[model samples]
Target: MKDFIKVMKALSDPNRVKVIKMLQQREMCVCEMQEALGIAQPTVSKHLKILEDAGLVQSRKEGLWVNYRLSGGGSPYAASLLGNLKHWIETDPEIIALREYIPGLQRELVRKKQASPAETQKKDSSAAQDAATERRETHD
Candidate 1:
């Protein structure tokens, strides 16, 4: 019953449950989730760790991004709960809003929005420098 308890604990947090609900639609990275949920990246990562520990979610590395999805293999308790979760509390207004928000989430745009001003400045300057170099090569 330890697995059962773990799954239950993972679902106890509203944010964690929301993460699961979003993953039910498609694979997502932390940045997209952070934007959709309006939560800090560290907090979102913490929730993901707990959900992974419970075997309710799995992750894979794609390039620099780690994407998460509902785990197909886990304790029987996890499978049962994940199956039932599809129909649970989905009618609530918040869940409906979240589902609506997922389609518009883009990781690149979300990360840019979250970047510090200095970081954004550095990127902008770097792009201008690269453009200058490209123009010099083209003229030479």
Candidate 2:
């Protein structure tokens, strides 16, 4: 009963449930989750903590980053819950609609990460030039 309660609590939040649903396809790091959800890093960590404590999610630390996924061999209750959740989601139209967004989300994150430092610097310089031009015009 305690385990059930904890699992239920962990899944009660829509964001956490979405996170789990996202992880259903593959393991993800915190930064990946942050990009996918478009939420703050701290908020993602908080939701992950609840899922981890409930034994529904497991994490492994590799050097500086932690990777998270659905626990395949944790408590029986958690495993069972995930299994049922998967089945339920597969049959739900609302969740099925998410398939279209997942690829875009993943691609956007990868594109952002792959942007060159020079590109960002160029943008910053352009913005500074624009600001200076505006200031000069105002003074004149």
Q: How many residue pairs clash in each candidate?
A: 0, 0
Best by TM-score: 1
Off by over 4 Å in 1: 129-140
Task: Give the per-residue lDDT digits (tens) of candidate 2, residues 77-109.
Answer: 788889988866675564565545666655345
Among the numbered candidates, top lDDT falls to: 1
lDDT of each: 0.94, 0.81
Provide the global lDDT of candidate 1 against the true structure. Answer: 0.94
